[model samples]
Target: MGNSKKVILLGNFGVGKTSLVRQYVFRKFSDDYMTTIGVRIDKKMVAVNGQEVSMIIWDVAGESTHQKIPNSYKLGAHGIIYVIDVLRPSTYLSIEKEISSLEDLLPNVPIVKVANKIDLLTEKERIEIVNNLPLNDYVLCSAKNGSNVEDAFNKLAESLI
Candidate 1:
């Protein structure tokens, strides 16, 4: 239960990376938007298969491209949660490229591809967007509404074990 794993949150700016972290760790959401300059770290213990796993979540500052992120922020990562705002096409248009870069940087590290802000989309909109994105597998989450936030993190935690 004392096992700790490093997890990184990678995505473009304003894709709700911090919001997802806050929602998962603190169960709180704020309306104000603040840019993460470098990186923010938060710790949450998740019960993965009845065992507590300490997730050291690194909310790195969002960059337009994965190549722009500092290597220091990505090293030693056990997993990554790549989040995308469902309402913002720009956030996910280059997902295929970004994910490929991520794989090259951290080979064998599991990434939980997430589509955040699903609460803002209707069922039809969700289906349409999912069909349009270049994604193999992804989880729909809404940080503002606390929907599937835990599941996304837990899935990553389980993979770490």
Candidate 2:
């Protein structure tokens, strides 16, 4: 398929938005940490149900403390994936508020709730964190280890269709 769909990755700083994209698109991960400026866009072609789908992923900068999100980055989005590092409780704490803001900005676009860095957490720890966060379409993934990375993309792509 030649069609392109805009998908966005939303989360706090260093929640692995870029890392997830790297894992999915390039199948690579790094130990270094780099903060995204305004936005970094990536593209990946994936097959869902035997049909090729192009996902244009927008990795937006982490929302500043007590600041509103940029409207321009959210426009024309087909799907949104909110990533949270399981080790960081603070990341998932304000998810309810974030989701509300996103829903208001892009009303009907499907959002996928993702808990990344699962490889760092114990099974019990993962459950404890996920239980606290709101779950619409939730997935647990480890970008460093390539666990459920494809599933996260497929879940969003499936919703796009």
Measured by TM-score, the strongest candidate is 1
Residue range 85-159, candidate 2, lDDT tens digits: 888878887788878878887899999989999898888877787777655568999999999999998999998
Candidate lDDT (C-alpha), each: 0.91, 0.85
**TM-score for every candidate vs. truth?**
0.95, 0.90
What candidate 2 gets wrong by more than 4 Å, as runs, is 64-67, 134-136
Give Cα distance to truth, residue 66, candidate 1, Å. Answer: 1.7
True-structure lDDT of candidate 1? 0.91
Worst 10 residues of 1 by lDDT: 1-10
What TM-score should be assigned to candidate 2?
0.90
For model 1, which pairs clash? none
RMSD of each: 1.4, 2.1
